[model samples]
Target: MRKDRMILRTPLPDRLCHWAMVVCFFLVALSGLSWLFPSLNWLNGVFGTPQMARVLHPFFGIVVFAALVYLFIRFVKYNLFEKEDRIWLENVKSVTAGDHSKPLRIGKYNAGQKFMFWGIMGLICVLLISGLVIWRAYFAHLFPIPVLRVALLLHAVAGVGLMLLIIGHIYLAFWVKGSIRGMVTGYVSHAWARAHHDRWHDQISGKGADKTKPGSAR
Candidate 1:
């Protein structure tokens, strides 16, 4: 697509951060699972050696948390809920069926996307705190055995929850034809923007005025 005809959906820095986080998250998740289940023990070899995986897992998890923090700062405005979000929520069944006959008045993100954004942010926060408490190399000694055990349980639950959310996110990205491309190239065709995010497209193209300011729905 021509540059002039495409809209910027993600900026270069944000795209880079997202992809980098994905890589680190994969490593961290595999190592975490390896430790959680004996059948998945070999998965730790993703870091070259099981011993290395143990040493690097927490560091990689930290990197993932930092990257998510950066993304939250950059994209939170666009993901915030607005009154029109109820329209998308109310018609989610039709939206999921690939029907766009009506104007959903979606912002840069739809209600579903906002849910994902907050879900991820919330899970990562849990993971970070729990991981820190259970981190054997550093802070584990600072906590009582009971506290450490509780932190370990929370960490495991949050990790599994985050992985599930990411899987859903990946599924939806592929379900929406141009979503991955927009993330990779930082642009989406005007038609794509219009179909998926009419309100955002209108705000960007000046076709209609919105109650909220540009680049945000709230």
Candidate 2:
């Protein structure tokens, strides 16, 4: 619980952007769901009224897409695959069991997180393109009836896919003890970082079993 023992994980701006996107994503998602299901139509109250939800959903969806773009640009470097990631992939079951005894050489993100990051990005891109094509207010008139139907189908599928991914993301964020705290406060304990992201912890703290030690000694 020592403040001095914490290392910066998410910075303030990124944290702000993340929470903002969360809000926008939920509002847009719920509103879209309201339109898609008669039973869920009441969910449009997220924007006060069904009509208002209809008017606001697309705009909020655009905001979510823009925020994700910023996040992708900021975090893409940490999410790239590396040779060490193969070790993590091989022993993923151990990781699922909450065992860090294996030296997975995890960096700022593990392979699983990298995959989720890219998956979310890819689905959002799909949603944006399809949404644009089917947007009745602005673009639908330009497209033929058959094209609009196709776009609508694609948009629905991508939206559902993204929602599923976000659900898993939420579950993992809460399942990991310190993960949510790191996102909320922009810092995490050295021990938490070492346990979850050993290689990154070593690189940032300049200590531990870093491969660089052998090179330096030589």
Candidate 3:
């Protein structure tokens, strides 16, 4: 059955930031593709060419990195690790088996989502720092060759990690019902929240609601 009502939630700035992050990452991904292989050289057309991608990849990374920095500054506190997060982690089986009844109650972001948040943060940090070590013609010259080489390796690993993380993030978001809408519309149906991210819905709406009993509709 489809839901009759939903709610407005995420702030305008947050929605904008989320989309900007997604868009910037796509641009970065495209530019990075140009660098991944000579056969994929045509991918550089988005930015210009291989040489152009060389110049643009780091620039694009800066944009994505900056946007993420803004998001991090805004939500890092809310996403901090907590005791409930541990319980949520321990009960992963229940969460995965479609048995949330006995699972730990959560807040804004669930344990899985929070873990991904941190993973994204870690990837961002690694990418930025490593991208810098080899971002020559200006800064790379300052670092030792050996250090730069190590940075090169780290940069590659971070790139792969980011790709996998993004794929996993999108899969899970789409996997869960009503999740995509919350991201796109910034709101979700009251019932949708109760079913998937109840704690977050409650935290946003005020307090938890009785799932077994009918209540005022939004």
Number of the top-ranking candidate, with lDDT as the measure: 1
TM-score to true structure, per model: 0.95, 0.93, 0.85
Model 1 lDDT on a 0 to 1 scale: 0.90
Tens digits of per-residue lDDT, candidate 1, 1-218, equal 78766777887899999999999999999999999999998898999998999899999999999999999999998888899999999999999999998999988999999999999999999999999998888999999999999999999999999999999999999999999999999888988988999988888776665433333332
lDDT of 3 by residue, 123-204 (tens): 9899999998899867899998899999988988898899899999999888888778877877678767676666666665
Candidate 3: regions farther than 4 A off: 1-5, 37-39, 208-218
**Model 3 lDDT at residue 159:** 88
The candidate with the higher lDDT, 1 or 3, is: 1
Which one is best on TM-score?
Answer: 1
How high is the lDDT of residue 98 in model 1? 94
Q: Which rank order by lDDT, best down to worst? A: 1, 2, 3
Those runs of model 2 whose alpha carbons end farther than 4 Å from true positions after fitting are: 207-218
- Distance from true location, Cα of 63 in model 3, Å: 0.8
Per-prediction CA RMSD (Å): 2.3, 4.3, 4.8
The TM-score, computed over Cα atoms with residue i paired to residue i, of candidate 2 is 0.93
Q: Give the per-residue lDDT digits (tens) of candidate 2, residues 1-218.
A: 66566777888889999999999999999998888889998898999988888889889999999999999988898898999999999999989999988777888898999999999999999999999998889989999999999999999999999999999999999998999999998888988888998888877776643443221110
User: What's the lDDT for all of these models?
Assistant: 0.90, 0.87, 0.76
Model 3 global lDDT (CA atoms, 0 to 1): 0.76
